[model samples]
Target: MDFKVQLLQRKSKIDKVIGEVFKDKNGLQKTVIEAMEYSIKAGGKRLRPVLLLEVCNILDGDIDYAMPFALAMEMIHTYSLIHDDLPAMDNDDYRRGKLTNHKVYGEGIAILAGDGLLNLAFETMLDSINNDPKLCNRGIKAMQIISKASGINGMIGGQVVDLEWEGKKIDIETLDFIHKHKTSALIEASINAGAILGGAEENQYLELQNYGRCIGLAFQIVDDILDEIGDEEKLGKKVGSDKSNEKSTYPSLYGIEKSKEIVSGLIENSLKSLEIFKEKAEFLRSLAKYLEVRDH
Candidate 1:
């Protein structure tokens, strides 16, 4: 199948899972659930969950068992976006060509919605484990990877640096730290957790982890490039916020041409890391290539 076709299929599956997550909305907190549904249903690439499932598929793991983890990964990612777009954070007005969470649901509800997603992500993972205690060990391990990645030393830590360094002259090391922690951490977790649940060998696990790190960094670099020169209509969000916010980015540090070169290098490394998987990794290889040229 074509890469985009495969991508759309996976996205559709992910969307289905998300849709079912809040279908039975009958409680006092229904509004919060609705808000949560609003953000998660807002269309995007669903890259994190797609990566998680693909990793499992390539390793011949049980997709049914991995489904909860994939959903959890997406929930955490969406929660971050909801908070990221708040008045106190990125202060954005749009996402995925629609109003941001706060814009439609009000800031208070949006805040609760983000919090609800974060908590429900854990519940979803734990529920899976509860339903199948035999897989408890694997489930716990995957959850641990995700927890650390989204925790204080990972995504949140990176966000702190990103917020603090806005409008400040930051060095390459600081910029790298922010990217690795804030963005790359969760991406790495998606792959690492999938590898664990997929029963990968130590070598395969390490290689996939490295691949995740490379592509994750490259993904952010592409975002940086797009922020500078991308079409806002295609992006579904305002462009040039990086400059307006004075955020430190690969493009800001190295110029657009140089940043593109860097993204190419990272994508190259990511593909190389999957060489051991050979033909089975063809989809992943194509994905890395796609990231290099994706407009949004």
Candidate 2:
């Protein structure tokens, strides 16, 4: 299948799984459920889940075995976005061309909704393990990787630093620290979870880790560039919010031309990491290039 066709097929599967996971339950709090569903259902590229499924395929792992982890990663990703858009954080009022969770549902309910998604993500993964006892170990490891990536050492930590460093002049090393933890952590976890669940060998696992790190940073660089050059209609959110908020970004630190250069370099390194996997990693390679060049 062509790349776009393959992406669409995987996206359809992910959408179905997400819908089933969020199906109605008796006595559920409608407001919180609505808030959670609003953000999850809001259209994005579904990149994290796609990465998981793709990595699993590359490793010759059963895609079915990786589905729950893909869903879990997305839930965690959505939760992060919910919190990131809150009044205390990015303070955004829109996401994916609609009202943010807090804007539509009120701050308190939105916070609860984010918390609920985080807890429920674990529940969903555990249920997946229970259904297939033999996958218990793989599920457990994947969970550990995800938990760390989403916790203080990863996304949360990055958020903390980002908040602290706003409007402050920072050096390249500090900026890298913030981006690696804030943006790259969950991405790294997504790819690593897929590899672990797929039972990739130790060497392959290390190579995938390197691949993920490069692409993860590149992803953010491209995002920074888009914020500068992209249309709101295309991006589906307020562009240049980083500049408006005075948040430090690669483009802010380095000029736009230089930022693009950095992204290209990162993409090159990411592709190089797949040299061992060669043709088996073509999808992953294409994905890295896509991330660097995609408009949104």
Candidate number with greatest TM-score? 1
Query: Per-residue CA lDDT of candidate 1, range 1-296, in tens?
Result: 99999999999999988899999889987999999999999987889999998999899988899999999999999999999889998788889899999999999999999999999999999999899888889899999999999998999999889888878989999999999998999999999999988889999999999899999999989989999999999998889988987877899889999999999999999998999999999989999899999998
Give the range where candidate 2 is weakest over 10 consecutive residues by summed lDDT. Answer: 22-31
Q: How many backbone clashes does candidate 1 have?
A: 0
State every prediction's TM-score relative to the real structure.
0.98, 0.96
Which candidate number has the best lDDT? 1
Per-residue C-alpha lDDT of model 2 across residues 1-296, encoded as one tens digit per residue: 68778778889989999998767855647778878988999987889999988988888988887898899889989999999989898888888898999988999999998999999889888888899999889889998999999999999999899888888888888889888998899899999999998999999999999999999999988888899888889888878888887877889889899999999998999998899998989888888988987987
- Alpha-carbon lDDT of model 1: 0.92
Error of 2 at 151 (Å): 0.5
Q: How many steric overlaps are in each model, in order?
A: 0, 0
How does model 2 fare in lDDT? Answer: 0.89
lDDT of each: 0.92, 0.89
